[model samples]
Target: MASLNSRVKGAVMGASMTGGWLLADLLLPEPWGDVVLYAAMAVVNVGIGWRLGKFYDKQSDKETAADFDAKKAANYELPS
Candidate 1:
């Protein structure tokens, strides 16, 4: 479930970035426009990548912790 959500989030972010770049290119003028468009794309992509990276990292941590807990529970024994 977490994996699926992460993939969906990544896909949405990619699609939005592409759409935004295209729109910016169309609306803005010549060389300066291209420059701005690329810059904005870079910045946005970096920000989104950073944020999603953290989110996935946290999700992975949660999954690892859950797995560890399950294993610990399964192996638990009564002290004599």
Candidate 2:
């Protein structure tokens, strides 16, 4: 199966965070201060998700490169 793209992953994470905020607000409405706090938290959540995606992408690239190298080595034939 195809893996989720980095942007898609970040979007999913950010969207889920927004949904959680909505649900929490509905359950317990807060004052203006909390609203502002939540907004900041939402931005922070999105940023964290983006950074996580970037980190994962880097790790995946490294793993892929290592696997390719291993496969190439496995197929190497010494010259007679």
Candidate 3:
């Protein structure tokens, strides 16, 4: 089995997000029939997926979720 590359991961993530939203759009009642909003949502989702892939590229195999939690704790500390 081959490991997935970052670019593929990003593309897959972006496509999946867009596809999921489209599926929802088909099933749900159209409250907001704005095409621009839907387009913007797809762009934002793709951007997030791209960023996630970049983040994955920077990670080391030895890194743990606890390390991520610690980083988050430092960066997003609640106001004292």
Better of 1 and 3 by TM-score: 1
Q: Candidate 3 at 21: error in angstroms? A: 0.7
Per-residue CA lDDT of model 3 for 6-49, tens digit only, reads: 78987897788779777767766666644655776878869878
Alpha-carbon local distance difference test for all models:
0.86, 0.81, 0.74
Least accurate 10 contiguous residues by lDDT in model 1: 1-10
For the record, the alpha-carbon RMSD of candidate 1 to the native fold, in angstroms, is 4.5
Candidate 1 is scored at a TM of: 0.70
lDDT of 2 at 61: 100
Model 1 stretches with alpha carbons more than 4 Å out:
1-17, 78-80
TM-score of each: 0.70, 0.57, 0.40
Model 3 spans > 4 angstroms off: 32-80
Cα RMSD of all models vs. native, in order, equals 4.5, 6.1, 12.8
Distance from true location, Cα of 57 in model 1, Å:
0.5
Better of 1 and 3 by lDDT: 1
Q: Point out the higher-scoring one by TM-score: 1 or 2.
A: 1
